[model samples]
Target: MIAMTALAGPPADTLWATSLRRWNALCWVLFAMMAVGLATMDGPAGSRYTALALLGSVVLCYAVLDRFPDNPAIRPHVYLSVLAVALGGLAYLRSNYAALFMVTLPHYWMFGRTPRASMGFLGLATVGTVAGSVLRQDGWTVEFFSETVVSTLIVVAVGVLIGLWAHSVVAQSTERARLIVELEQTQAQLSEAHQRQGAADERERLAREIHDTLAQGFASIIVLAEAARAGLDSDTARSAQQLRSIESTARENLAEARELVGSAHRPGQTAAGSVARTLRRTLNRFTEDTGLTVDAELTDLVCDQQTRIALLRCTQESLANVRKHARASTVGVVLTRQAHGVELEITDDGTGFVVEESTGFGLDGMRKRLAELGGRLTVTSSVGDGTRVLALIPMAFEAPGEGEAER
Candidate 1:
């Protein structure tokens, strides 16, 4: 933690300013005491000289205190106590200038900075006032002592009030800073949640569109191919083989459409279904139509609905790309879960293209979707070499049966 320095910045409530004002008031009171000493003195030469000295002292003290408000060492109580003790002794020696002892009361205001220092100054001032009054032969009567005691009590009371007020100001400033930090953290969390919600909504919308359009179109194609196969003559073997190919393509498209819709609709619907099952079903349909062998190694690991869906989507899109562009005979899919997160790797021994040079919407869209879920997609490929796609997502598990299970 950084230590707070007096010169770091001014307190928001002008605490230092208030302190300076109190010091200035004390200086003026000291000047008043000097004026009283001068006006009441019996000798003109001594009175004028004392008044000039007191006036100069008051001016110098005020200048120093006012100019260095943020100085850690320049405490108000210390300055006032030194002034009071020195002047109190001088008044006692001059016996006739006893009225100058009134300058001690301002020491009460100085005690606001350090309680212990203020208490020490208060004790000194009380003692000096009594000694000066008595040494000046001011009758040392009960009435005189009573009056001095009353003045000391009043000054200490005022000092206590000012000290409490300063402490309260510091506490309020600390609380304000703490609250600001909490508010910023809350805002950041809210922004992330909003972004996640937006992506989820978009995925649902796209899934609905594909289900209504592409899925239905594939179903129609499958029905027509079946009708063609049934009506074809046995002699037209070549034509029948072509129709079977068309039927296989229609079935593959229908499976893909169903998987896309399932991913969007059942986002968090994790049950006994394993990643391997989902990947196999998707790859089988792809290979049946495209005749590309998919080699896969999938471990049994329970994942949350979102993680499973994201992994499945990564696999589907990757293999789809291989079929369309890789021109390779074999592809591989691997799934592994570690302490930190789950990883999905898809590699195709196809004719690979430069990752940076390839500008395909499918790859970019897959990356964006993963990123929204705090996952990342990395692609490594070049001309002639196989392309590899890796997806990694951080995992945080809730207790089984905690939230509404996805349908």
Candidate 2:
């Protein structure tokens, strides 16, 4: 029953609604054409007889058309019955030419929306034609029987072809619609994946900035303060006072770094006043006391608080490495926005070493910090060649609940 229903196509209710409208229009047109043909035809049996017969067939066809909208199988049987009556009436009138129209009636009737039902109608029509011709002739000669059989076969074949073509068209249309729906679903999934990937990237960048800047600076202040406390009894009282001042300043900077880091972790925190400006102030203070040429080129690039902190830390780490290892002339810091990300270049004409052979914690820590933020750090240096450290962080990375901000 399920297979049978599937073969019929769609639900019976929908098919009924669609087929009824079409059949109603077709029936009316068929009735009008038949009525005109009957009126004009002059017959020995009389025009009244032909008119009554065509009118009766028209009435029957209309009744069937109206009734079988909910049942497609019944429609073809109704059409076949009407054609049989018309063919029989024409044969009685000795109008063989008009009776030939009966052969083509099944062709149209059998090729309605349902192809399986139409094929059944085609078989019925073929049998009825052959049987009617034999019964009317009284004596079936080979010549007459062969002609009727051949004509019936031709009509059936044509109806079958029409039914197959209609089925093909409907199948193609259904498949195209299904494919379009699938394509739309796939596009939606891809868009969602891209959004998620962008968010993950941003979170990592924030993590890297925090580790490099605030964390490393606090460690340095702790070490320096302990040294000053231990050496206060010696003649290094001036150095102890200087170290005490450095400790106080480091504590102040630590408070600022904590606030910035908190804002980066928390969503919806306004980043208007907390950006490169704060970092620049800290760097300026460090340069003033140390007399280090901190050639800083910081931009007004707007980023999340966490990302800002990460970038600041990255800068601090690079500078710390410069102060510790790169003992040379001028040091240059360049921070610039790229097409898809940001780049920070720290160059110094210091005594360079083999990057592969060195197992320093500072460089390794820097690399690890950048990786968390979906960024990369590359160190380019050789013996006596000016050391250049380049860090690249993609703008695509965003923390959860945070969106990309313009630079």
Candidate 3:
């Protein structure tokens, strides 16, 4: 397998650049042989001139290509090999440049070529090398030609053998590149999964810590404070009622905190009744705790369990926000089942503040919860005006038979 990290190039160019470099290096070896032939030729003057002219043209093409290695136009062109083959064919007509031709064989199989091209080049190179050798010898004699052909066959066969080996190397490099990309993608997925698992673990850990420490302490303080506030009937006790009210408020906050921590890992809904009953119970509890009146018009809501839980949690969040921010006397809530879906609206005659681009996490969390079940929430409010929150949750209609079958 090819190890790209051990090679040299820009990161994106590694695969093709490395293969092209190897191809160019092999082509240069053929250039060296042609140079040697031009330097020392013992053939007849006419043969020598023809050989030099053909070989020189090949050399000039090589130089042009060498000057522009980064040129995309020249990168994968097989015209270089085609020109060399033409030169070799003409040189065989006069002399023999068959050995120089064999050195050019490696460039064809080096990289980014189809097997069919490789096969065709094998046949072309083999034929050119053998024919060049036969033409170099003056032989109408069968024995001389037979010996020349046998030797040429051995040389060309060896070239094919080595070319096959280099082809295997290119194949390995290609596969190694594919596996490297697969490994990177798999590692990324594993990293994301590990992060998600770690976050979940930390959430569970934080929940446990709150339940064990803050929750227990708050529960104890709330019981003691409740008893203390109830026993106060004297005016002296009533004078401290404001302080006691603060204590009870802290306890109620602790109650809300406990509910959150306790249900941190509860997979599904906590509501046990129809949407109307759950809303009425939540409103009643809000009234008893904060001493504010809430008028609700509710009806049966047909939704999945998760949607039901989402509505209940959003209600709790809205009421909790009102208790903390709204210093008003009355609130209104309405839930109705329409033909398309279910809608819930909560409005309050509170000292509402200006709505800014950034809302607190309370409102954002409610929006996200409803959005998950194909639901949407819209909040409308302004300074000193009332706040209204409307939620629309979509559910697909199921046939009566399908519901009965599931049951």
Candidate 4:
């Protein structure tokens, strides 16, 4: 016998484990009743005692096997053999105890491990019980065959049909349970993947916001500070003006940083003045800081918040690029209300390079921002030539009244 402490009990199938428990209880009840009958029933003392011992041995073997059902050392076939012998002996010892053989039929199906194996054991038990009864009789009598053999065959046939049906049901139920567990695991994995993608998209958005706002501001400060330092001795009045521009750029950068941290505005959306007014203000600031001449033709236009913000950001990014890369003396900004949409164009007479070779983030960010609002950006430039950036956004609103003049 294996040590009880090392055994993990029965299988993990809840339905099978529960059925085994109930089967065990039924076996115990039958054993107790048989033991009481054998103790008091009229029979030869030695035969009755021998039959009682066999019955007790059968119950004890079953109890030990049930206690460590998964133990490798204890084989189920050995128990079935013992049970067959006990049923045959009981039939021979007392004809009244023959019902025990019928009651033990389910044990074959439960422990046989397969339908074929269980049917083999059931046949063995049936033949043994009948042979024992015949050997104790005078001859092959008609009454005995009719009363015992026929009834036992009928009971065996019914048990076989019931066992096969039960096995089919259990197999289907186990398959369904496995599929349900796999489905839940798949759903959890998909949910985790979506969350990771959302986080990645949010990070890309924040990078664009910084590139368009605070980063541009800080670059302006650096340029103004350099100019102020260089002209400090020779051009005192000009140096003072450059220092003031640096201070103003730093304050604007601070505000932009606060807005980013607070998440005050949705990406690509802002609450600002009219589109023309905003562009004019940005152009005026650029002219002041760079000492470059700016010719502006901006018309007051009514549009949605997103459209206005997109146009303003394009102008700002264009001016910043001009300040850093363009060595041009004059810049031109044109804003017009078209038939179906609005357009803003910025042209600079700068030392330009090929458009295809340029891989700056500002131009791409501007394109993406406009694309989100169903707008488009076009850039035309080449070596030794100037650059032109045109942004067009489709809208359905009528142009503002003629009283609203160009800025």
- Over 5-114, each residue of candidate 2 has an lDDT whose tens digit, in order, gives 12223434887756655665565566457655655666555755665665567566756765665775665556655665555454444435334544344344333446
Per-residue lDDT of model 4, residues 47-69, tens digit only = 87888788888878888888888
Per-residue lDDT tens digits for candidate 3, residues 22-46, read 7655657656675556546675677
Relative to the true structure, candidate 4 has a C-alpha RMSD (angstroms) of 5.9
Candidate that beats the other on lDDT, 1 or 2, i.e. the better one: 1
Q: Which model scores highest in lDDT?
A: 4
Among these predicted structures, which one has the highest TM-score? 4
Query: For residue 250, what is the lDDT in candidate 4?
Result: 89
lDDT of each: 0.64, 0.62, 0.64, 0.80
What is the lDDT for 168 in model 3?
A: 67
Ordered by lDDT, highest first, the candidates read 4, 3, 1, 2
Model 1: residues with Cα > 4 Å off, grouped in runs: 1-44, 70-78, 86-112, 161-289, 292-407
Q: Count the backbone clashes (under 3 Å) in each candidate.
A: 0, 9, 0, 0
How far is 385's C-alpha from truth in model 4 (Å)?
4.0
Instruction: State the displacement of the C-alpha of residue 227, model 3, in Å, after optimal TM-score superposition.
Output: 12
What are the TM-scores, per candidate, against the unseen true structure?
0.41, 0.46, 0.50, 0.74
Give per-residue lDDT, candidate 1, residue 321: 75
In candidate 2, list every pair of residues with a backbone clash: 201-397, 202-397, 202-398, 204-372, 204-373, 205-373, 209-310, 213-313, 264-306
